[model samples]
Target: MSQIQGWAAQQAGQPLVRSSFDLGPLGAEEVEVAVDYCGICHSDLSMIANEWGMSRFPFVPGHEVIGRVLALGEQAKGLRVGQRVGIGWTAGSCMHCRQCLSGHQNLCAELEATIGGHHGGFADKVRAHWAWTIPLPDGIDLPSAGPLLCGGITVLKPFLAYNIGPTARVGVVGIGGLGHMAVKFAKAWGCEVTAFTSTAAKADEARSFGAHHVVSSRDANAIQAIAGSLDLLLVTVNVSLDWGALLGTLAPRGRMHVVGAVLEPIPVPAFALIVTEREVSGSPTGSPVDIATLLDFATRHDVRPQVEMFPMDQVNAALKHLADGKARYRIVLEGAKG
Candidate 1:
């Protein structure tokens, strides 16, 4: 067993505290990683607030982890000690399940999430399954790559799943963390990108992120002007909006993918789908394969998250900053010297 210091919440709605915890002996297929950086995710804030009410107390909340391998178990394969690696939202999944067999590991029924079902990356060190650890490219630093493990891949995989050609017209909704990345990726792919945001202040910021057009989704006229104009709309907002209005912006056979959490239902009119034969889908964080592909693509294209760094001991302040939407984008926690 190994003891390491980390920030954990003793109860829901409480601030995370720096404490020590035991990392049990590694299994044959597991390895111990010395965590270098961890990204604070919006979902982490939700979990800490117990919004979903499934939070496990003494919870160390983080899924976007970048680290170096400290030790590897005997059965661990293809990884070496001191290698730069990362752990995403998934710790492991049932390999024999249909979803896993089909390469849809994210949807596997037996999936073990990094922070939810298992201990996550907010610690100074963690034990992870070998299959879930991905090698970080030498080009990307651990701190910047931390958000890529979650926010970066969450938006990237959905675009990858679409597999659209370079000529595709991509529209990204919302201008926050995920939406900004979506714009950059879409533009880099040689697509004409449009940004949809409710806030007028975000228009210039959206274009700066490579969006070709910035439209206010709040204006009825603005919404109608883009009606049936987009080949793909990536809805990245967590709050519910008029799904029909957004759907109306999709071109024929165009799809709208919802990647954020809406606490309440979005009123979806059945006719909206029936008319254009359009589709709506949702996506979660990526699998290990997806993460690897994203990292490579990001490295090749110089795509990185805008981040604000915080010390590990100030995790509570970090979470509060995230909850308050005060961080410009992502908040990363760096380890403190003992």
Candidate 2:
């Protein structure tokens, strides 16, 4: 093994600094990718700040990665050298687990997160199990495709799990990174899309992103105006909101699903769900099969994330920009140029 260059935080809540470290050896089922572009996700901030208390120090935080295969282990399958591919939140999983055997590797009990205890794509090179390294389809733009690996799949999985159809009316809560993509997917899937946001400025932008309607998520009246109108409501914001009001917008038997990482308890009136038989649920990133399906759908619909670019060396600046809420949607880091 040789030293690989990357930016990392020495301690929790510390700014990222340029550093070099060894990658040890590639596992039998792993493949190495030469980093090209990596998306800056809010989850990266959580790990950098150790918000979840599961972060390891010297953290190299990036999971949404796009790169070309530089090498592959002897036992790695379905990938070749120089293949352009993407890796998401899960780097590896116990292949024999019930979930993995059923193609739900994301839910495996021993899932290995890219930055959980391992270095991630904020480096010159990164590695993942061959099963999780998905080959990019022909039509996806390389620069903007990174976020689809994580944020895109997070939203897409619910649609597949719930079997939402073309006639369903869908609502997306939030208009930033994840919510914006949800709008595009829902629209492309033939659903009438409504975007919920607190910012008046985003209302029009949400429509431009394929939302059929825009409502102020903070306005109780606006939320109530859409009562019993939606078949599915996707919550993508990390902050707490008026759950009661949001629930009211769903039709009887409609489902409210959470893909966001909201920290506090969401209080729901029992009668709100009990009377209508409405349901609430949450999911993590999707399995490899789901990622493949998402890529195919994105290519077919020409869906791409709105992104700002930063060079890998300027990762700290990029992180600050995302933290300041300055990014229009998603931020991506270009790898060190050869």
lDDT of 1: 0.84
Best candidate (score: TM-score): 2
Model 2 regions lying over 4 Å from their true place:
none
Cand. 2 Cα-lDDT: 0.93
Please write out the lDDT profile of model 1 over residues 1-338, one tens digit for every residue. 57877788889888878879877778888888888888888889888888998789888888888888999999998899999899988888877888888888888988888888567888888777898889988787656888888888888887788786689888898988788888888888888999999989889988988999998878778888888978889988898777778889999888898888877877778888888888888888877789999999888888878889998878888888888878767889887531
- Candidate 2 per-residue C-alpha lDDT over 1-338 given as tens digits, one digit per residue, 9 for 90 to 100: 45678789999999998899988878889999989999999999999999999999899999999999989999999999999999999999999989999988999999999999989989988889999999999878999999999999999998999999999999999999999999999999999999999999999999999999999998999899899989899999999999989999999999999999998999888898999999999999999999999999999899999999999988999999999998889999999752
The Cα error of candidate 2 at residue 144, in Å, is 0.3
